[model samples]
Target: MKKKGNKPLLDMLQNIAEGLGETLSPFCEVVVHDLRNPKNAIHGIYNNLSGRHIGDPATELGLARIRDPEFPPRLSNYANTFPDGRKVKSTSIGIKDENGEYVAALCLNVDLTLFQSFQGAISQFTRIEDGRVHEDLERTPAERIHARIDEFAASRATTARSLNAADRKQLVQELKKEGLLEIRRGANIAATHMGVSRATVYGDAK
Candidate 1:
């Protein structure tokens, strides 16, 4: 009787594990690729260092001198799942064994998906009296300009099912006049977040 009860419990645990693994498979594959690329690079360097082929001894020794003590020797991955279900970012660690020593290093990347409902809710909360206010009240003049340009592009794209050339041009002019275009000139975050181009924002503004 006890064995029968435990069997069900074990089956439940296995099912849960399988479900979690299926959900995480894509992210895990990305993490594996990230780790593998750098590990291959390092291994190639090590092979050259060991005089497996032909290379300068001092150069190889110099490459070997880079070290950090806090990491580990086996590959490990860490990821964070956003509450909005729209973004996942992961870090991959590469482990190495060096002369009876273990060393590890990390590479990190972010994967983002937009959740319109979540964004709308947040934007709504930030608005005062049915009017939206700039989120970066403390930003520099240039930063504010860029932010506004990105915001305009994002707003236009989100609302328009199909924008004509004239409409796009108008949107660009409006963004530039509002000082949004200047801010985006130096930032990748604005482009990535808004899902538009630095070129589009700049060209339209111009």
Candidate 2:
């Protein structure tokens, strides 16, 4: 078995990190890990957080990929915490070669502290009536979806993940009533937050 670096693929990954970093800038950090070299797996990093540098050792996930050939390829948004106590949300994707070998990985970490602070500030400002009542204008579609999910989960006294089929249906109906499902790609977004599939979301929407 011959193992060699894939220049084209690496270049593409680098470009992807750079592009995403540019858009999210200071809030997002993108890192590329080369599985072939575990000791120095960090081949590239953009919008650096965690104060990590190129040639840094593999992360826990990177090491896991090295050990398990059947490791999941894609990891969706999940919570993380920095050493300095900053909260983060992360997603990771593993790249495989023709031989079904994990060759590289791309991970994105988004700092949530700034956004939390910003949300708090906005909440305070919104609370102060400016001579006119403005509708809930500060929250984005995703935020709204998350809020509704949280509210539903609270009502059931269970986590969103614990929502049964009936619970999900009711939650979906509530979301639809709030006009959340009417937004572009709203079903997909809501499904992701509700920990359900797009097909499930569609069924509930109907």
Candidate 3:
């Protein structure tokens, strides 16, 4: 059977490229290169994140493939860069004919800036601070109340007794929400810990 030119294979790859471009969306760039014509290799571009267009020259890898057909057919997750200096993670695949001649190439370049920023946010969210840790086993009602008070004070960089009026009012409201004030002598306990009178705690709660 006499072989056809690169059209049929190019058409098939173009379909696959369109699907991948739509599926991967804005983060990925997909480029189709017609290897037969190195100078005007870019046949089409999809999800064009790299700022390239049709009729662009083939990449160095494509040129290498043409210069030496023995070159690797696929190189995946290779490091690359955009013209704006953003990082790129890329993959390229060379398509060959029945005669094993390089006919075309498909290149996928993924924008890593978004992922890198997301990774930073995740790292900050999941980070753990060192020391000054307290685990409330709820050993006793009074202990739970006092521990929570201590934690609240520690967060404000002050001792329970040193809490100002604003801090005290906020703490009293939060303590009431947790039903800490409902415990027996809880008001007395809070008054003693904070060096305040029962009347003051009650006023803060009101």
Candidate 4:
């Protein structure tokens, strides 16, 4: 039989665990099933690259390890979730056994409810939706812009010779600041503009 004092501690621990599990149920579902769609495709391509799966041999080996089971441990995983008319940020961690083998994964989904509201308020205050300019959130915003400009120039059967580097960068920066980049136009945009595999773009973006 358990001692009276120990019984209380056990009860408290159980309660805490249950509470945490309840809080994270939605996020866990998304990580395992929802996020895995793209992840699996990425793995398939990587496997093909390593000759573990049958596919075109022309596949580059650089990205082969992304799907490798032997890939290094990751501390956390991040994804975005849209639920109840709000967007939430989700994070998940791998649960490991005593011997350091992964047993299962535990996830935490946080609703950035307040932050989203705060952003809206700030946007209104600064009249960002108006003709005013804004800053880009992507770290490589300038590079991304340059890439987009190059693609646009090429599609028009022209080159960057028509637009200076500064001009192209400015256009990209302006587009980013206006939140135009966040709008999703499906897999085609990512594939055409970014030169990334459809799987990678859909998986991460979805």
lDDT to native, each model? 0.41, 0.88, 0.90, 0.41
- Model 1 residue runs over 4 Å out of place are 1-157, 160-164, 184-190
After TM-score superposition, what is the CA distance of residue 86 in candidate 4 from its true location, in Å? Answer: 3.9
**What tens-digit string does per-residue lDDT give for candidate 4 at 82-201?**
435555555444333344433233234455667678899998898636567877777364455446657766765666445444444454454445554565543444344545455644
Candidate 1 overall lDDT versus native:
0.41
Q: lDDT per residue, candidate 1, 1-206, as tens digits?
A: 22233344334433543454355443321211112122232221211111222121222212242243344433333444533454545444443433332232222333334344567889988977646665655886555645555565566664332445566667667755655555535334344444566676466556
Superposed model 2: Cα runs more than 4 Å off: 1-3, 128-206
Off by over 4 Å in 3: 1-4, 134-206
How close is each model in CA RMSD to the real structure?
Answer: 21.1, 13.6, 15.1, 23.1
Winner on lDDT between 1 and 3 is 3
TM-score of each: 0.23, 0.60, 0.63, 0.28
**TM-score of model 1 vs. true structure:** 0.23
Steric clash pairs (candidate 1): 73-95, 145-179, 145-180, 146-183, 146-184, 149-180
**True-vs-predicted CA distance for residue 66, candidate 3, Å:** 1.0
Q: Which pairs clash in model 3?
A: none
